[model samples]
Target: METLEAADMTQLLMESHELSTMINQSREVSDYLSAKRQMEADVEAQRLLALFEKKKEQYEDVQRFGKYHPDYNHISKEVRELKRTIELLDSVQAFKRAEDSLDELLYQVSRTIANAVSGTIKVPSNNPFLEAQSSGCGTGGSCGCSVKKPS
Candidate 1:
């Protein structure tokens, strides 16, 4: 019985590796990689991203002091504006869309695998909308559909 279990585990590992390779070769991944490369190669986008990161760090520092900090409002506004500017870049927008697409595809694959193992198995997702919709807990588990602990 132990030997059979070991064989099954090895087979499962090999199959998972194949699945990973297939996913890596998928169009979603290809688009994501292309968009990422474009974003990285854009000089303006890189500059804006660096500025955004610096402003975001400043915002985090001021956040701890709340509104009482002298630079809080300025830092907050700067971060927001920088973020908006970054988002407006074509390369940044394309990268974000491709990333989201790839994320959704991976999420679907995870959900399929989990459901195959057991229908009750809940698959965690990066997208909040997917988590709520896929888990049948549309109301965020307030309707008594929450997972129960085994007694």
Candidate 2:
């Protein structure tokens, strides 16, 4: 019976360890998804940047001409193009931030799940996680953890 008990403990520990590994692997998947999303967003961003760079000289020319010829029409279009580029860049930044937030949230959730399974942490009551440790009774008597308490 002692051997059987040891085997059960070994199996439980192995399963917990595997679950931890899977959680870590899923975090990597989130990272990969973020990278792919960023790559797609970059295309539009770079196009806008390129437009700004390519037209800068033209805009500068119109600015210099409009100083002498106050009724210049080309200057207005150049200004509008600059605004369009700004809007595109802003859109890219927003997409990147959304992707980053998704990755961060996924990582936090995976870590929480991994800790719950392997750390033997007692789950908090509904609506009580905020103050869970405030009324602690120390470690519960039957903590699944096998670690010895400090002497």
For all predictions, the C-alpha RMSD in Å is 4.8, 15.3
Runs in model 2 lying further than 4 Å from the true structure = 1-41, 67-71, 85-151
- For 17-61, candidate 2 gives per-residue lDDT tens digits of 886677556745565566556755787676766777767766676
When summed lDDT is taken over every stretch of 10 residues in candidate 1, the lowest stretch is 142-151
Q: What are the models' TM-scores?
A: 0.85, 0.29
What's the distance in Å from true for residue 119, model 1? 2.2
Q: Which candidate has the highest lDDT of all?
A: 1
Q: Point to the candidate with the largest TM-score.
A: 1
lDDT of residue 64 for candidate 1 = 98
- The count of residue-pair clashes in candidate 1 stands at 0
What pairs collide in candidate 1?
none
